[model samples]
Target: MIPSRSDWTKALEIRHGKSLNEKFSKSTVAICGLGGLGSNIAISLARAGIGKLILIDFDIVDITNLHRQQYKANQVGEQKTTALSNNLREIAPYISLEIKNTKIDEDNLEELLLGADIVCEAVDVAETKAMIANEVLTHMPDKYLVAASGMAGIGSPNEIITRKITKKLYISGDGVSDVKNSIGLVSPRVMICAAHQALTVLRIIAEEFDL
Candidate 1:
């Protein structure tokens, strides 16, 4: 069951301290995909006390996604936005969430995600991923973006690293790995990339905001 507001606050205070808890509760994040990387990154941000989330995706959960994505067997056919919101609300009951159950394209990009404190590009297709990353990084220069290049298969944990692509865009992953017949997406490596993205968000919004 989800904990009470006071109970949740106490837990977050213990982990992130009092000041960070306040800032996190006021921040907003937009996740452009709802796959392995996006799901995990959104959850991390929720747990860290982010106040609002803008979740966008057009895909539904599939059995194949179980290995790496954050959905259950019962949610096999549910929309990714619905499934993720259900899970996130259960964890962070008080978190405010906005869901866009649609596919992101160049035409709707700006309208879909505007005024977000941070944006994450976690789509699977290379073309869509690149498109969103470049658009957000170049157009929304003031906003921070976290993009993942590669996180397929069980390889060296150290291989996944966060690279700063620009002043506001950061890429996290091995940078070369791809999903193929020989290698598949695993939770460990995917989470590593997501971790870097999540932590970097915290660093920018909270840690360095005062600097």
Candidate 2:
């Protein structure tokens, strides 16, 4: 049986302290792109008791995604938004989720991420990443954005670092590695960047800023 909400939050309170856990439990985070980086970031945030997650991804899970993404073999043909939401519910049953199984572009970006306190960019294409970052930073001035840049290849995990770009924008990853120029993405390196993004969101909620 699923645990009661109080019992569920009690555990997070112990690990995160009551005040921090309350903040986490009240935050809404939007994750764009449910690929390796996005999938990993969603899992981390959900596990941390983030109140709601807005998951946006237009792609379906493929066999190629099994290597690094958080989907199973049976979910190969399933839509990423649905699959990831299913998985997250199993981990954090009480966590609210808003899923959009459609591509996120300048046109519908704002509406999709309307209530998010923070947005995470995990798209694969460089152009798409730039567009989302620009849109969020330019249009959604009030929301915090955590974007990744260079978690590709088998680079040193330490190279995956988070940088504060502005008051509301933070970037994670090596800022150098690219799949087209490198040996493609490795699971560990991708996850490192995602963790940085997830932690950055938490820190933002906790009123911690990087100087």
| lDDT of candidate 1 over 113-195, digit per residue (tens) | 88688898888898998899878877887788878888887889899988876678778898988887436888889989998
Residue 45 miss distance in model 2 (angstroms): 0.4
C-alpha RMSD of each candidate structure in angstroms: 2.1, 0.9
Distance from true location, Cα of 2 in model 2, Å = 1.9
Off by over 4 Å in 2: none
- Writing each residue's lDDT as its tens digit, candidate 2 over 23-126 gives 99999999999999999999999999899999999999999999999999999999999999999999999999998989888899999899999999999887
Quote model 1's TM-score.
0.94
Clashing pairs in 2: none
Question: lDDT of all the models against the reference?
Answer: 0.87, 0.92
